[model samples]
Target: MTLDLVNYEQKAHEAVKSFWSNREVAKQKQLLTGKADHGERAGVTAGKNMDGFLALVLDIIQANGLAHAEIHQNRSMLTLPGYFRPTKLWDLLVIYKGELIAAIELKSQVGSFGNNFNNRTEEAIGTAYDLWTAYREEAFGKQPRPFVGWLMMVEDAPKSRCAVRDASPHFPVFGEFEGASYLMRYDLLCQKLVKEQLYTTAALITSTRCAAETGEFSEMSSMTGFRPFVTALAGHVAAAAARLD
Candidate 1:
């Protein structure tokens, strides 16, 4: 069946918009009262806040006739055994008839680029490595390899857009990363994740707090764009549906 991507895009926009709105509300609430709420005390953890977007993905999965598949999103059920680590909780999972179908991780960054860029990159690479190694060791039990995906959303701010200096104490950094912005860094990260075969696909999206309400978001390229992400996911669900019987 043909996919209604336009509608899906609108839903995604709304979902992201709501995410930012909730963050702002939480921030403001913290200001009024000295007590720190969830987002205020710690930081923005959009992972749990992204259920709306994940729901859209679930819509695609269900539409493709994989509604019978086991979908795990709860914190407890999302945990999957890892090769290196004891267990890792994924953002979403699709299991069917004892076979691993798909696993996805969703992340977002609003600010603190300088402090968090390295951490985010390390987590992305490490997580993919752990998951793949576990699969290689048959952690999921003689099942078909699962489709892994990563989707990252970053706030469109001056700091993130400004070119960052790469000071390599020893060897010179690569030409592509000599003088790149945080946004560029994220784009490169996603591109490399797919290029290195760590993830089946990855997407990078950016949007401002004000623009989010208007459903405004930008993508670096078609490869890291949301359309490609949803399309690839939909195609995978369709293929998996065929095997359900």
Candidate 2:
């Protein structure tokens, strides 16, 4: 890797380490090592962590060829509605070609495999409603907006990988989980939400990927290898977003 990669990872680590430090989630989880509960909150926090990690990823993705957000990019993070609004607010907004092409919500499983998953299912579905409601009201109408959704998670190599199932109908129940893959399990979630006409657009994205520290290249980074990967990924995303025009 280049010196720039090293620098980005270093900065990324600091950012992730400081994540839960936000007053809103300070009590949710401990910084550094991370908090407990291990299910949906972990996913939620991981999503939040991705927000930090993206700083590095977005930088790299821009260099490559992918749409992404930037540090100085014209963007804003706000409360979703009530306490729920801010807590469940969309993570990143990508502006491309003078239009709104996407909205992302990052989530990862930090041992939150059981109960926490259920909670996140609720939050995600609920937040989707909030997003759509906000969207039509000109939340992202500064230009043509594409209704997009992203649900990402960093899961531990589980002892058992469960089969995928579409599980949003059973909301507040099986919606959070059908087996192991929460994101995919809720694969039909976007469709269901759309069917309800909850939102005005149909560009949806939901993916589940795992992360581990294999080639940490350094003792400090032994816990995870996402720092480098995401750093390299940032540039690609940025370049893509810039190209949307």
Candidate 3:
């Protein structure tokens, strides 16, 4: 059978809840048990949970005719007088639909969604800023047209305090507010997506790893980003990520 998100969620929830429900287990353990580990995956990083999302991105790249999910590429060809390092980088680069597009760093959410927004905002800008090197080079030499793109994965959350969607709608809308107006000109491809409207397809998944017979809490569903046309869009994203060298 396919992976059941509900079951995984419940398991994580119960693991977290057990901190309070089973005080004995909390008190008994020494090195591994503490308030620090009170919640389910309380210490897991955002990148840790984004593997699946990244996989989807990889699939999007390939389906649309791009290349592999290469990482940590060095592009610092020139050195500045007194500025940031010469070597620059983009997370994943591939020629999408025949154009060399760079799928920059991915930003994810963890802890309080609002706080997560701050972190991701910085990450998004940093991801884009790497292009400054090429821009400077262009000023001196033949301009190299590099198509950059950003893929964000908003992880699921429940706690109101940690829930980013609850903190501000703009948290999830970072791409619109920040990426849309970064450079002299916006990406025509992305603009086309927005004007034409784009989307991705995903199965509605929920996890339920609660107490076996204790009967506890659960539920979440969103179709806002899903549309019939999304299948085509997702395929494009996938193919784009796959075609690059």
List lDDT for all candidates, in order: 0.84, 0.43, 0.36
> What range of 10 consecutive residues in model 2 has the weakest lDDT sum?
215-224
lDDT of 2 by residue, 1-245 (tens): 22234366465445444443332253354444455534334434333445554565444444444433332223344233332254344565554444554455555444444546567667767777676666667655545444344433334334213554444665555434455354344334444544565433222221223112221212112112344234323433443454563
- Cα lDDT tens digits for candidate 3, 1-245: 12112233334334334422333333344225444443433434212343433444444444444434332234442221212445444454543333434333433333354445545455545434545444455522442344444533233334422312223555464443432321101122233333432212222222223332342432222331212122443444444444433
> Where does candidate 3 stray beyond 4 Å?
1-42, 67-84, 88-90, 95-100, 132-144, 155-245
Q: What is the per-residue lDDT of model 1 for residues 129-160, given as tens digits with 9 covering 90 to 100?
A: 99999999999998766889998988889999
Please provide TM-scores, in order, for all candidate models, with all chains considered together: 0.93, 0.45, 0.41
Ranking by lDDT: 1, 2, 3
Residue 36, candidate 1: Cα error in Å is 2.5
**Model 1 TM-score relative to the real fold:** 0.93
Write down the lDDT that model 1 would get.
0.84
Model with the higher TM-score, candidate 1 or 3: 1
